[model samples]
Target: MELIYMKKFLDACHQAKRITELMPKLPERMTPRHIHVIDALFQLEQKEDSVKVSDVSGFLGVTRPSITKLLNELESLGAVEKIPDEADRRVTLIRLTEKGKKYYNFYVEEYQGWLLKQLGEADTEEFMTTVNTIARVYKIVSDQKTAPVFPGEE
Candidate 1:
């Protein structure tokens, strides 16, 4: 049973690594980090009038400095605009520019097509069953509030 679990865990890790490697191949004007930022921006775009750097940093689980750097790069590329909040002078809000929206749409479409091609080659039923099982396991793990024990952890 333990060996079976270990084999499944390693296989899942390998699949995750492969997916990570494939993400950078998408057509986008930014790095993976920047693309991730754009994704977040898109999520917030409709929910709120604008998003803040701190909001993105917290949502993405990234540091303020890293978010700032990404924002600066995005700004330079004319992909996003930083608008000062009217209520607070200290707060700077972020919004996608037209160019950013166009690029994001292109990136999403290309990525979906790529993934569909990859998954289409697999046995659909088996692949979906595996995905559903993994989703259930992920939900179970995520529902636990405490930190999980790792090997050699005290």
Candidate 2:
């Protein structure tokens, strides 16, 4: 049975994975996970005056302990700091340091430049249509799946 559509989907996935080669590499002492955390903080801070550890954990869909560990590493690198909330002395909030801001700005600029270069006069509306189609297909596929099986459950 030749699933021609599946072949195209798998090929697209391979190409998408390869697209990372065009991305700017992270600066020293920063991993992809760190970038994710910084991005979450960047977006969350836009809506909230102060972002808590739980905010990041919820944004990233990870455990609070895992977020705390990553925050500790980021803090050690001077990328983020934990400060007491002004209204509540016992509550702490997370904020990016100047270094983190630099990282975020640099990466966003670089990534945008790369994406624009790749677009190279492409039609914006058509590009968006294609992106939306892929997202809808993904949602349909995900909705068809049952609960995921864990390793030990099998």
Candidate 3:
């Protein structure tokens, strides 16, 4: 890639990272990682009643310690519960509490989520530029049709 476009790309990447910070957030509190963990639990909730720590870890593809850390927070926040199965004393099952269900609902139910507000923030000219540049870059990388044509290429 050329130096000028590379510089702009880095700037856009930095802006994207701050996109979440720019928006109004949910009440229970969270980081990006926490969001994913909660989402995994919500997806699991849709499919199975026997949700265990192992099940969450499997869904997230993360190590036990990482899921455990998030689970501990979610449990303490009243968003989740960890209970030992009746038939097996050693196995623990995890599930969303009513508060958690509300929290997940808040994320999925609306255009109010920060990401959905991105398009509204950009003006017409800026939005078109971003879209066109992204399309050009995608075609260049995905199809290998040609070298990247930066913003003002002949």
Query: Which number leads on lDDT?
Result: 2
TM-scores of the candidates in the order shown: 0.65, 0.69, 0.62
> 61-139 in candidate 3: lDDT tens per residue?
6788889889998888888899989999998899889987786767654434545575566577877897798767656
Least well predicted 10-residue stretch by lDDT in candidate 1: 20-29
Residue pairs of candidate 2 with colliding backbone atoms: none
Between candidates 2 and 3, the lDDT winner: 2
Q: Rank the candidates by TM-score, best first.
A: 2, 1, 3
**Per-residue lDDT for 56-150 in model 2, tens only?**
99998789999999999999989899999889988789999999988878776667677789779999898898688777776776674665777
lDDT tens per residue, model 1, 1-154: 6799968876986887576566746445567667778888888787887799998898887799999999999999888999999999899999999988876776655675777887667788987887887767677776767658777973
Off by over 4 Å in 2: 125-153
Model 1 has a clash total of 0
Candidate lDDT values, in order: 0.80, 0.83, 0.77
Question: Of models 1 and 3, which has the larger TM-score?
Answer: 1
lDDT for 140 in candidate 3 is: 65
- Cα shift from native, residue 138, model 2 (Å): 6.3
In model 3, residue pairs whose N, Cα or C atoms come closer than 3 Å (at least 3 residues apart or on different chains), thus clashing, are: none
Give the runs in model 3 whose Cα sits over 4 Å from its true position.
Answer: 3-9, 111-154
lDDT of 1: 0.80
